[model samples]
Target: MSYVDLHCHLLPGLDDGAATYDDTLRHARRLHAEGVRDVACTPHVKRDEFPGVAVREIVERVAHAQRRIAAAGLAIRLHSGAELAHADALLLPASDLERIAQGPADARWLLLECPFDGIDDDFALAAARLRELGFGLLLAHPERSAGLLAGDGLARLRPLLAHGALLQVNVCSLLGNHGLDVQDAAVRLVREGVAFCLASDGHPGSREQTLQLGFHLLLRAGASSTQAYRLTQANPRLLLRDGVTRPLFDVEQRALAAAA
Candidate 1:
């Protein structure tokens, strides 16, 4: 199956993602060429800086980008959603979370951002609250979290996973660009069957980096291609669906075999 990038900075002039419509178009073209059939335009909903960007505004902007892509005859489908920062969690009204939770192509999963600091009980409670309010959470790049990088990070995440939260690790982390400890943690997460997806939290200037490289890293680390595909493609597709929780073991086993 063609890949779908569940997390990306594709929307033009929204936050620090793509700076212009042309830049957006360029990224779309690149994604299509890389066989990315769908992409979520995950502009930052960081609480510290972009508080003014309401959920409705993000939806409209995403719709506008989709229109532009269609007009330009790009084969790739662009979906609108926000990479909502942890700080913006409670700040966004329940209604707004509902609106922003909409995925690129009729998807139900929300691409949630973790705080740069660490995951805490409050965050976990907030996530549970969101679930209670009927939104599926796809935690973005937890490998970057210092707590997750520490010895006991996985223990903390185990409960969240049981609570229907899916984990997303950035492709760059696998490359050790974030640091060896993070890379080790990211590998361990995949190897131990913790992370559900590996995405290229691709910025505008760094279009050359692809999730394919991350897939290779996972495979080399003993993940089967099927598992890698599931994390990089299948699971993400399901995530884009109605945010249903699925078993991770089968795919991880398949991915390990494929890697072998």
Candidate 2:
């Protein structure tokens, strides 16, 4: 029953995640005890505020944690990825985008975060641009986004999904740590089968964000054991192995070629 967390902030000094190396070690132990065998260190990449995490920095910190985990005999493995702010996706050049990408080095799964305040009218365009660049989009925590909570929320998300974007929900959202509305949204997304995965989005302060609790909560919310495992493990594993998702639109390789 090995689990993989596709979104987490376990690296120290990168963003609002773990504050130091010691904190990262503690997070690793907790995740290992909770039955997570692999984790993606998905720090923030909002260009205005957090911008993006540096690839070298992520590698260095992950190496440090791996050595410590080996010394402590923990079995957890680390992968690198970023939670891109929608604004950054539009502003960054393709080459710069490549540097901040998260996932296995061979894979191009970019975790994207929508605006918390609201979805910009042009947000869909930004998502399309990323997809055109050949990166698979894994949207992070749409249930927390105010835009997704209001109006025809599900309708608003349809274009992104149609464009082959996958949705990820935070564990905290399922457990009501974020609030009743967010919990409802998370549960609704899970129950409706709209969400492609569940993640800790864990950044050090909440018990509600553990992967183990999330797995059970999904079951309690109506997901069978196998379905829960697919969200937390199999689907993400497939993303890493396949490197690209089914394109939402007719893809023109010219964009990727030009970007390359």
Candidate 3:
């Protein structure tokens, strides 16, 4: 099965991602060559930079990239989304949240980027607020946060997971590129059934350095190709196609059973 990169910085000139359209196209072509059939253009929507990347603009840019890729004969599918930073949580209105919660196709799942700190009560509160406002959250790249890897991190994250937040870990964490702690935490999360998905989180220029390396590490870590495929492909498809709602996980079985 072809992979679906759920957390990629592919939009050109949008934020700290691809600086040029050509670079974005080059990254898309490379992803296609690596067997990624679907790529979400998750430009940063943080408090610092890219505060102006509205949903409409993101959609338009993704459409433009799609056309360019098609014209270039690349078969990869480009989806539009915003990586909502934790700090930006207080800044976004409910409507803006709804807009970015889904993709261009209005898939209800939002790609939510957590803070570098870790899962905290504030995050749980934010998750609760989003839930109340009617959006499913996909917490991005938790493995990079030292706080999340500290004492009883899983315990700290349980409430958020229970409240319908899905954990997304970058494949780089599993490759030990971020360090042994991140790699160990990632593997432990996978083992404990907290991690529901894995993404490349590939930036344009760094595609070759991260994307394939993450996939290779997941495969070597004893993830059956099918299992890995689901994380990289099926789950993302669900996020892009399903409406906003918490995904149903069979916590007892340590697997996602369906989308709720």
Off by over 4 Å in 3: 103-107, 207-213, 243-260
Cα lDDT tens digits, model 2, 141-186, are 8998885756555567677676677788888888888789888888
Cα lDDT over the full model 1: 0.75
Candidate 1 residue lDDT tens string, 174-248 = 888888988887887788777888888888766446676767887976789889998888877776764544354
Judged by TM-score relative to the true structure, which candidate is superior, 1 or 3? Answer: 3
Model 2: how far residue 248 lies from native, Å:
10
**CA error at residue 97 for candidate 1, angstroms:** 0.4
Tell me the tens digit of each residue's lDDT in model 3 across 1-260.
Answer: 57777888888877777989899888878887878888878888885877567665777788888999999999988877788876676567887876566643443667777777766777667777776666777889887776665665556766667667788888778877878888888886665556777888887776444445556676777777776766677766766677434334334123433211
Q: Per-prediction TM-score, please? A: 0.88, 0.87, 0.88
lDDT of each: 0.75, 0.76, 0.73
Off by over 4 Å in 2: 51-56, 102-107, 206-208, 247-260
Please tell me which predicted candidate would have the highest lDDT against the true structure: 2
